[model samples]
Each structure stands twice: as C-alpha cells, then as structure tokens.
Target: MSVPTRQASPAAPPPASVLPAVPVEPSPDPEAHLGLRFPEGFGWGAATSAYQIEGAAREDGRGPSVWDTFAYTPGRVANGDTGDTAADHYRRYAEDLDLIRDLGLRSYRFSISWPRVQPDGRGAINQRGLDFYRRLVDGLLERGISPMATLFHWDTPQALQDDAGWANRDTAYRFADYATAVFEALGESVPVWLTINEPKTVVQNGYITGHHAPGIRDEPTAYLVGHHLALAHGLGVQALRATGSASRIGGALNLHPCYAADDSPATSDAVRLYDGYENRFYLDPMFKGHYPEDVLADQGPGSPLVRGIRDGDLEIIKQPIDILAVQYYTPIYVTTDGGTVQKWPTTQAAWQQVYPPGMYDILTRVTRDYAPPSITVTENGLPCADEVGVDGSVDDAGRISFLRDHLAEAHRAIADGAPLESYHVWSLMDNFEWEVGYDQRWGLIYVDYPTQRRILKRSAAWYRRVISDNSL
Candidate 1:
C-alpha cells in the first residue's frame, strides 16, 4: 500500500535551534547538594519485559514471537542462548512478587506478551495466556505493589512479521485491535498502561543493524517501520481511552541525548542530526504533531518512511498521553564526521556507559521542550559481572554505586523542575538479556537460572533502604 498524501507539501526550513543548550556538567540545585528527599508518593518501582523474563516460549496456546524466531536462528544470539526457560518467571511469578514486597518496591512494571494473549497477534484472546498476567497483577496488588503494564515490548507476534510487520501500514490498526483485547481483559485493574516500548530500538537495532529479531539491514524498511510504530502508539493510546479505564497511557521511548565529542562546528552538526534522529523523530510527532523537517530530508526522497506517512497520520500519532515515560541509560557523543566516541566508563553491555548527568539532561530537556504533563524514568540500570559467593550473598557494590549516582541525578532533575514523578530500575532480577543472552546482568537480584533460585544482591538490599527512607 502507498502512503496516502494529502497534497504536495513543502518541507519547512530547519529550526534555528532543534534542542536547547544543556550544560556539559550541570550542577544540581542547592537543595540537591544537601540531598533532598523525593516528593511524597514518588513511585519506586522496577521493570521487566515479557520476552526478557517470562520464559514459557511455547506453552498453553502461546505462539512464537519475532524474538523467538531470531533466538532460535544460529549465530543470531550469543552462545546460541534463547529465552526458552529464562529465569522461569512464567512459572515462578508468585515467588518473584514476594521478592518485590520484600524489597519494598511500591510498583512492578512488566509487559504483556502479545503472542501469548492473541496467539497470532490478532483475533480471539487466549484465556490461558492472559491468566498468567492476571495472576501476576493480582499477586502484585495483594502485596500492595502497583502494577504498570506495557502492552508491547519488542515482542511482535511472528504472524505480524510474516505480514511485513510494522513496515506495513495495516499493522498499526492490528495493534490497536490487540490493545483493545488486552484492555477489555485487564484494563479494570492496571492503573498505568504503556502502549509501546522503545520503537527507536526497533528501527535502529532490528532494521538498521540487524542485531535484533526479524532482523533486516535496510534503512528504507527501518524508516517505514518507525512510522508504523508511531501510528500503532497513537492508535494504542486511543484504544486505552476508548475503554474509559482511567489509566494513565503513554509510550516508553529510550531517548539518547546527543552531544558533540569536541567543540567543533562539524561535530555540532553531527549532534544536531543525531538528536533529530534519536530524540526529535519520536518526541515531535508525539507532542508537536509532525516529524522534524531535517530528519525527513536526511532520509531523502527515496525513503519509503517519508512516503508511508499518510494524511492525518500525525494527528493520530499526536494523541494526548497522560504521562511521558522516559527510559535513559546513555548519551551519544558524535565526532565531526558523525562517528561515535566513547569517553565514559562502560558497563558489561558495551553500549551502556556510566553517565549519570545524562539522566538529568534528558528529563529537563523533555520538560523544557515537549512539556509532557508528567514524566517517569521507566528503565535505567547497568549490567555487571555479578555472582553469588560461597556465603550465599552477592556483593555487587558496583551496581549499588551505579544506582546511587543515577538516583542522585534523578533527584536533581526533579529538584530542577522536571516534574519527574517516578523511577523504576530496569530489571527486577537477572533474566534473558536479548541478543547478548544472560551474559550481561542488570538486575538487583541475581537469578540462579539452572535452579531458578532468586538471590538478593547487595544492590537490592541498599535499594530497599532507599525506598524506606524515601531518599538516596
């Protein structure tokens, strides 16, 4: 299908300032220096995705997801590892809920497996599949933990991929159908709903780099997929509102705040383009009702994504979301020629660098620029080489330090008038790290995968203290 054009529209001139200038080393407010406590009722939670943790790959009416296909392929995943039995969360959710309560977590953020619920990504709902989430949500509530459910977290149903996936315009509406099914089944209980998680990653990693599921190394396909994902997000928002569940609906974007590697005009240009692609591409449509002109031009006339955008598509994609979910972990430093430069300490996940100030930069930028009603850090944590000692305790001081620095920055963001409400650490426990497999550990709790035994690391214990004190 061709992208329906309204008229031959001329692209707008490039804005004088695409992003406001952010200080390289922003000093926190005076109160932050004294370590001010988070505002009352600040949400303290942890996040886990279905594909990364829930490892019931093919059971009880569940169908295959794109990730399943990718993992099963040789040389696609590290060490040929698949999420077939990841952490066994599908079978051991109750125990995990107890772990959350013990850690004093106020909320639990997790994603619903689309293929598990709809089997083929569309049509009849699978009761057995949803039963798992129902039980998980109930368990969370029973433990006084709020449930924040994400509808899709990179686990596109295999059937959808077979139909050209997000590259096809029809996939957006199909996603809405799937969202409605989930809302009808579980909407009454879930207070927070995220429509989609990290569509940029889907475009960059899955389509451009071919590092993720349904991997395709084609820029044109990535461009088309990006727009369709946005359309799906907008449609998903409407679907949630149609149910009238009074839930806060939003999309989780993994935003990378781009900066120049050095004080050079060419490097500054690279930063501008990088920001246009990484941040503005998603933020503008969600808030301003259009894609950035420069980014559209950057892809050129041959890019299908530019043509795939139909009339009134931006209007649909710009639905009012009650909250803006920001997932920040790294910042990009581009050289004069657009090459990446690494200047910070790295995590086990090589792409992740230790940059706490980027958290503050991103949150404040969203506040000043897009002005979303509310904001929450949905995912932020680092991977480390963690293991249980003979004394039956995991001493992961590195993770504790990482959390401390990041949380401090979050407090700074809130103090600086970012309207930052909640913050959720990435994974509740060590589970499947997609593509990289279980090689990287980003969890507060260590998972003994073979036995499915949960061990609370030193970081978990420290986080519990932070929660109780309501301060870092």
Candidate 2:
C-alpha cells in the first residue's frame, strides 16, 4: 500500500465570532522552591497502537489480524472503514517522530503489530517487520525521544484466532513467545515496555459488545478472554525478564471512576457493579493477586464463565511492575430509578460521561489501594468536533480546557502523594477511531483524509506550551 503525503490546502480565515480570548498570566512556578518534584527520572510521552495508527496491514509478509477480518466485514465499522491505510504511520514514521520532537516530548509509547512481527503469530520471525520498528525506535533515539513499546494492543493474529482466540489457554503461551521475540529484538533501546493495552476493552468491546475486532457477543466467552489476557500479562512479563533485558515492564488499564446518580441504596449498588466490571476486575487480580470476590459473587448462579486460575497464576499476574499505566477518559454516572440501572450523559461513543474529577479520584484510589508503583497517566483526552474556520485557524478551546482541567487534577494528585510520574495524551493526530471510524476527532492535529494534510489544532498549540512550561 502507498502512503499518502500531507499537502497544504487553501488557508481558511478565522471565525469573527470566536476571537482568541486574552491569555491568562502565568501562575508562580510550582517547582521553583519546593523539594517536591516529579521523580528525577520520570517519563513524559504520547502513545499510539499498531492497529490504531499503522496502516500497512498487508505489506512485508505481514499476515492478517482478527482486526483485519472484522474491519473488512460489512457493517463492522462506520462508513465501512477499515484500517487498510490508517495514519500511514508504518511508512511515515520518520515524519511522525519529527512531530514528536517538535512537541519536546521525552518519550513516545507505541505498540508492535503481532502479525507483522510473527506473521502467523508463531514460529518464524519476519525480519522485514522487525526492521520497521527498528527504524521507528532508532528514529526516536536520533531525536532524543525515549521509545516505550507495548507488545500487544488488541491486534491478535488472525491465525491464532482461527484456532481458538483468547478463549484457548494456548493463545496465552503464544503471546508470551511473541513478547520474548520483541524483547530480544528491541529491548536494549526501548527501556519501557507495556504488556497489553486495556484488556477490558479487548474483552468487553471486542467480545461482548461486538463493536471491535473479533466481534463475538458471547458474555461468557468475553469474561473468559479477560482472564486469559491477565494470564498473558503475567506470562509476558516473565518472558521479557528471561531475555535479561533492562526494560521496565508493566500493563496499561483503562479505568473510569464510577459515580452514583443519587444517595439511594440501589444507585450505590449500581456504582459497585459498574466499578467491579470496569476497574476492580483488572486491578484486583493485578495488584492484590486475586479477583474481587464481590465481582465473582455478582456474576451469580447463571454466569457460565469459569475462573481459569491456576495455583501460581496470581503470583505471576501480580509480578512487581515498574509503573501502572492508567488510560482514563470520562466517568460514567449510574442511576437506578426502579429495578434497572441507567447510564446518563454519555459521550457520542455512548460509553462515558464528561467528568474531570474522575481523574483525580482514580489516581488517588489506585495509590491508596495498590502497592504504589510509579503511576503514569498513559492516556487521557477528549474527542471534539474540531472545525477549521474560514481563516485557517482551528479553535478547539473546549479540548484545550478539557486538558487543562484534567492536568490540574493530576497535578493535585501528585501533590497529594500519588507518585504520579507523567502524563501522555491519548493521541497526537486525528485518525480512524475504531468502530466509529473517522467520525470522532481526538487528535491534537487534524488530518484532511483526502489530501492527508496535517493541521495543528488549537489544542495542539496549547499542549506545546504546556510541554514547554512543564506545567499546565
């Protein structure tokens, strides 16, 4: 597949009605005199996944992933969009690295394509596929940006899925092997490694919701997949350690703090249920070395999912991690009017609500409850319908404020002893948003799909200043 080059389009004029507001004066520098500061060796970065950004799904001996099959099927994605040629990051990584450098980022977090590296998800290695990441890591190093690599980001090889997918225990072993291959190849350069990105999303959206890849709406199967993914994380860490690599390994969980709609008992119960499904299901096994008993009890007598826990699985899954990557978006509000609970004020994605305090609450809860590993706000950002005005200026004040408010809460969390190390926004550019396709714009920069032109949105410029000042 040929990658498209970004071109300059005719400049549009600024909207007269939305003039720039007067800039606020800077607050006194917080780090000036205080002994408190981000850890001397903290990381600052931006993250992207293989399937989310990389477009060369078919080139260089890369085999199909479950995502490839699901996306290509009719009615699977908005506008029938497939990741055939996403951001073209596979071919234009150098340019992308330049963008990272321009933002003065200290690190860049990206994922490896399993099918790309091990074409069939097992056996022979694809040297060509490895070379692409070699180039990407070297490029980041050349620009002084540390490369943080994730082994699995929900793009399981179609060959593996063809056999039994995550439902089969063998898939977990294959993932560990794949992890070892990646660690051996790039571990020296990529100091930070994440085992997986949001296993909950992988199981819930991909399996139960039938809204993502490997679309299967089997609740029992989805719960089982969740267990296997946790197992994979534990085994993957062991594999990376066996390589004798100096990389720091961890897992990324997407957590959204749940809030009750009212003080009623039913509403509070709804909150617990939602939290069990969203947060504790992943964290309890990881941090406490056991599944939340409440969650298991709530599953009730009718639930068909069986726990795949082996004698030593908890110890392996709870292996000490260097950091906890928390990808937070918005929180959900749960209300129980009668016998049923309802979600209110959800996003266009219909999965979340706009709640900034959730960030602070989540950070505090993780610190209070877990072993207090260094925490990084791995992914946090909003999706706005950013518009380029007639004057060629994009005014995304809403997104800008959204970032500022969240960062402010994060800063407060750090001040209150959360060991909060770094914050990486969810994305750097506007690209395909999974099942929603290109409908949602979450990028700091806007991409004109037809011409592949890149336009820095107002939020991007605002973020650049945040990076420069090292504060919000």
The digit string of per-residue lDDT tens for model 2 on 314-387 reads 89888778889888776655555312222333334444455667889999999998955788877887667778
Candidate 1 TM-score, C-alpha based: 0.93
Q: Please list the residue runs of candidate 1 whose C-alpha ends up more than 4 Å from where it truly belongs after superposition.
A: 1-34
lDDT of 1 by residue, 1-472 (tens): 0000001001222222113322222134211333558999999999999988889899999999999999999999889999899989998898899999999999888999999999898788899998898899889899999999999998899998999998888889999999998898887689999998988888877887788888787777787888999999999999988888888899998887888889988778877877888899989999999998888898787779887888999999999999999988887777666666666766666566678899989999999999999998899887778878999999777777677788888999898899888999987888888888878788998999888889999889888988888986
Q: What TM-score number comes out for model 2? A: 0.89
lDDT, candidate 2, equals 0.75
Clash numbers, per candidate? 0, 7
Q: Rate the local accuracy (lDDT) of all candidates.
A: 0.83, 0.75
Model 1 clash pairs?
Answer: none
